[model samples]
Target: MGTKFTFYEFFAGAGMARAGLSDGWECLFANDSDELKQLSYADNWAGEDVDPRDVALVKASDLDGMADMGWASFPCQDLSQAGPKLGMGKAGSDALTRSGALWPFLDIIRDLATEGRHPILLALENVVGLLSSNGGADFHAICSTLSDIGYRFGAIVADASYFVPQSRPRVFIVALRREVPVPGALRGEFPVNPWHSKILLRARASLPDTDAANWVWWDPGAPPAKRLKELHDLLDLSDDADWNSDEQTERFVGMMTNSHLARLAEAQTAGRPMIGSLYFRMRPDSNGKNVQRAEIAFGETLGCLRTPKGGASRPRIITVDGDRVRTRLVTMREAASLMGLEENFNLPPTYHEAFKLIGDGVVPAVVRFLAERLLEPLASHGRAYAEAAAIQKASA
Candidate 1:
């Protein structure tokens, strides 16, 4: 064998990183706390041995002898807008304090470094809110800490829309050891910034001229990448999964109608022209719970997928036709399709688990994008390290 690169995945929920990295790297260890997710992961990677233990409860000392690369898609409950904004504090003290799981990640890195078993590469994923949390103080702290630990960090905000139909945007950080010289010349050109020109102009008007650096100017002339997939294109309607109960469907429709009416009344009260009716549907689970709901927007694309939290739930949808008819909720297969999982990717035995996994899992296409553009370039360095070790042993 030439060389084998090893991977240790932390917070490896349902093996999103595993799905993306397994083909490119050998996974030596994986961990997660959810039993359902663990079962799903085991089912997905049938032959791979993964231990479904709680990482927060596991000692870093136990990981002293395994893996060469570490990949963590830690729980973003503390960093996500969906959760509390506890930027690196203990969970449960407050809603904001609940979102700070970044510390656990750092703790693992610190332990690995202390034992001189620092992985060659470290990759982390989280919500974009992490960048501006605590007025960017949290981001600074994270970068500074990693630098102190002898790692050079680079980050990018990649949108799933680039490869999948959904508009899920996430922040990814890749940290490499300081001893490794980054191939700066091979760094891809920065993606063109895309924002509504009117929004940018309005934002600049609010800022002082001295603070021009804070304003982002959109390049209207730049040719953007093609908008590749659509919400409908990813659905596998043939699958008999993800149906809601009649009661749940009625409740969802009622909620959507009420929300739509509220918006319509608000527009009328503001003297704005009333748009057509917002069509929506209820996506049911096997147990008849309304796991997901979809609403059609006036003309814009489908709103981002989010966890359904009762009030004003789910992303908004736009209606294509002029008639203002209501629509049904998105199907389970559609959700899976939108997430870019393979057509037959492990279907949870229950609707609730299915929605949870889809909501929590990383989009496969986004993972593939990282693998090709970011991770593959570092492969040669890993191979070189392995080869050097082999030569040293042979000479000895």
Candidate 2:
């Protein structure tokens, strides 16, 4: 490869994000704490630089070499919508250190800066809940820290539904180290663009105006996504495998609310084939009763895949064919497809492992699209600087 841009994947879970950077760039280093994930990464990726250690314990010397970009999809459990809403607000305490795993990544970045080899671009991915956690204070604190370290930050709220069949809305932060004047005041009207949602707007408003100097609104012109009539469009031949038992199917239906049951009945009685994906959540129903309700999506879109921690955490497929409602847990391969992974990607050994690996990942297609746009300007600038320096040396 000729001068390929390289990146370090911090929190590189099973090399999924690295899979996204396969086309134009290469991974210089990868790190994650979980050994199971590390085994998956090693099995799938041939990179020898894979480091399986807690990020907090990783030293700056370990990442001494320079790279063009750094990708961090840090743990969002503490800040996720489904998990504890402990935002990254703690300063120096253990709770802060634990809940805000972003701190260790920040410390490493600071070390890189000290080494005078900081990556030109730093991209972070996390759940959208990061913006609202601690009333938007967590995100602002991150912005402030990035600004302090001489990097200008830009962010966008992107949804995997735009690229894949799953609705995974994540906040992506792209920070660049460049000199620029203070960003102008926020416009009176913040447009509800695809890249900026209401939550993003509120998060931006929380930051001090001074921090805006390095803040940019990143918008890559996204083409309209193709509409899906059914979830089968994204399914593979291997996804046809069913693992649900009779008792399991009954339990799943029993969890559905009356309204959902009626809808299923109506769809079945319509005398046509109706295919949908189901997700269970223990929440309130229309009758103000707390119960496990089966939420079905009729279109190509499916709900976000989460780690299979509980019965509700796993996604199930509901197919209504000629008055028969057949249900089965979505196959692991189907979960991989939903994550936009390549067909030939090596999956983990067990079903739960495979599902977990894909579920807690940045969709590969989305990452490739975003990373390409984010690197364009930086690449051009680097090339221009190198050419100028060459011309000066030649003249001398």
Q: Judged by TM-score, which candidate is best?
A: 2
Q: Local error of candidate 2 at 78, Å? A: 1.0
Write down the RMSD of all candidates, one decimal each.
8.8, 3.9
283-327, model 1: which lDDT tens digit per residue?
A: 565687875443434321344566555434533332222222223
lDDT of 2 by residue, 78-162 (tens): 7888887777756544656344877888888888888777877788999999888888778888898898888988788888887
Show where candidate 1 strays beyond 4 Å: 1-4, 47-49, 64-66, 90-98, 188-228, 235-301, 311-320, 385-396
Question: Considering only N, C-alpha and C atoms within 3 Å, which residue pairs clash in candidate 2?
Answer: 183-213
lDDT of 2: 0.76
Q: Which stretches of candidate 2 lie over 4 Å from their true place?
A: 47-49, 89-91, 97-99, 180-192, 227-230, 236-240, 243-251, 269-272, 284-290, 382-396
Model 2's C-alpha root-mean-square deviation from the true structure amounts to: 3.9
Number of the top-ranking candidate, with lDDT as the measure: 2
Q: Return the lDDT, model 1, position 221.
A: 29
Q: How does candidate 1 score on lDDT?
A: 0.60
